[model samples]
Target: MGAEGKTPRMTSHDAAGRSDDSDHRGYLDGQLLIAMPVMGDPRFERSVIYLCAHSSEGAMGIIVNRPAGSIDFPELLVQLDIIQKADQIKLPENAESMKVLKGGPVETGRGFVLHSSDFFIQDATLKIDEGICLTATVDILKAIAKGAGPKHAILALGYAGWAPGQLETEIQDNGWLHCDADPDLIFGGDVEEKYLRALRKIGIDPGMLSNEAGHA
Candidate 1:
């Protein structure tokens, strides 16, 4: 579904509004969704999504794999005017190596930072899990430019979302397989191996996985 604008900032309340609702059972918040081969949507084919919030209302997540091609973090800083071009080389090691990811198909123009919880802004950060948080403001970009941001972070240019019962139906139809999330799976630098790794983590060998549609 479509959001309001290009840069819609999601607060903790917005992300986890129905989190405590008793009817919001079996939600997959803070988990990983691995797309099965039978998935009908090409955008999510072979995708590995990190569920940030899940409740009776809906679900939101970011694809941890799928690098945003040729998008350099330092150059993005310059483009956003967060830092001058001359200061590119002065960026921290973490900033220099930060990977820019295509989070999903929706709101592709916006940037969302899925980061470690070490850094936070009073009302801008949405803590998805113990060590993971999501911040969608440019203020975090400034912090990164100054080397004062989270220990680990990735810039995702959009996010995946599902209406109430949509994700559950997909799971029931064997469109996805879910498993627990870890820092390595979410923040690891190897963008290409996440899908296969996630399958293996759930004890399913990729080679043996079939395109059959059945319960996950």
Candidate 2:
């Protein structure tokens, strides 16, 4: 899960033959994806995903709303040898309350850190947007354990991945609705309310949504 290699650069072309940032080319990068009511996959039902990267190559995101049951951050630190059992009670306030989420179905054993831009590690962090960044190395975890990490963050086990054009096709098929992302929406403690909150952010009432896909 170490992100030590060179990060892939993704660019997009505009109509006038000009190149632009992939996120600005109508892609869902750095946005929140709200699973449609008719979602067929049980793994993603009512999921609220924060897209970290989206380009012609593929798309990658973390499910921010699904808690990784039975996983506790302090215990995880002890397991990883970042701290000892006796140190659990001494964890900082943010570390004590930090969430552990099931990012997605892929690479479930690995860890990904979706955090605020206040902290960074050279070559290990991918700045997703103005306020968010993704780091898949254990270094950030050590920082968090030491109370030297970002202002806000969540540790996700695994991530959602799509092949080239696969996500675009899903979007065209009405599998998702995307909207701008905010720190509160991404890092809030209300896990069960994220899906509904994301829908409301897109100006849709959850109670009014139907299972007809496009009718939402």
Candidate 3:
């Protein structure tokens, strides 16, 4: 059900940002935020994200499968100054081309990698969990340039972050539905149906969803 709070403001700057989305708080880390089928918010409709961090203060997640419009994989590498061979840019065989995704509306120039924790950025890597890891350092980019990165990976140009209590309020208000995230859902699935599919993963039929949430 929607919370007793108001919709949080979308701020422009990081430091200047403040949030009111939290009337409640907690993390659904490693969980999936599946967009409700009736959602009309352009930013989140039909989106599926993996919650990486959460607390009473705020939350952050990575949108795994939404490709940034008109932007292909190899083109993203070149934009990031990573050179790829013409013969290998779109190699016919097996190679996950360097690509970019529309992570969120927050930052348009930043990049983040959401991959299995089985791959680490050396020893000092910040591990999210036993199954997932996030490496933002340019070294990881360099590793990707050399094709030495993780087995399954998604490159997001931006991210989705909510302020303290913001995410909680949304959940309480039912802005998003929760489900256990699947690797296939995040890395190799059709994003067009990902939200609905994720809901199904948890046995929640999308047809049962209603835009107006209520506490019974």
Q: Among these predicted structures, which one has the highest lDDT?
A: 1
lDDT of 3 by residue, 54-173 (tens): 767578898865777665555555545555556344432113454457778776566677777766755434465567777665556556656676777776767889998888777766
List ranges where model 2 is wrong by over 4 Å.
1-24
Candidate 1 per-residue lDDT, tens place, 1-216, comes to 232223333223232223355664577888999999888899999999999889878888999998887677888888777888999999999999998888998877778899999998876788877899988888888898889999999988889999988999988888998998878989999989989999989998899877777443
Steric clash pairs (candidate 3): 1-172, 1-173, 2-173, 3-173, 21-165, 21-166, 22-165, 22-166, 57-164
lDDT of 2 at 184: 92
Candidate order by lDDT, decreasing, is 1, 2, 3
lDDT of 2 at 20: 40
- TM-score of each predicted structure versus truth: 0.90, 0.88, 0.77
Candidate 1 worst ten-residue window by lDDT: 10-19
Candidate lDDT scores, in order, read 0.83, 0.81, 0.64
Candidate 2, run of 10 with poorest lDDT: 6-15
Any idea what lDDT model 1 has? Answer: 0.83
Best by TM-score: 1
On residues 1-216, what C-alpha lDDT tens digit does candidate 2 reach at each position? 322221212112111222346366768889998899777888899999999878887888999999888787887788777899999999999999999888888777777889999998775778888999888777888899899999999988878999999988888888888889978989999998988888887788888888886662
The per-residue C-alpha lDDT of model 2 at residue 118 equals 97
Which candidate would rank higher by lDDT, 1 or 3?
A: 1
Q: Which stretches of candidate 1 lie over 4 Å from their true place?
A: 1-24, 214-216
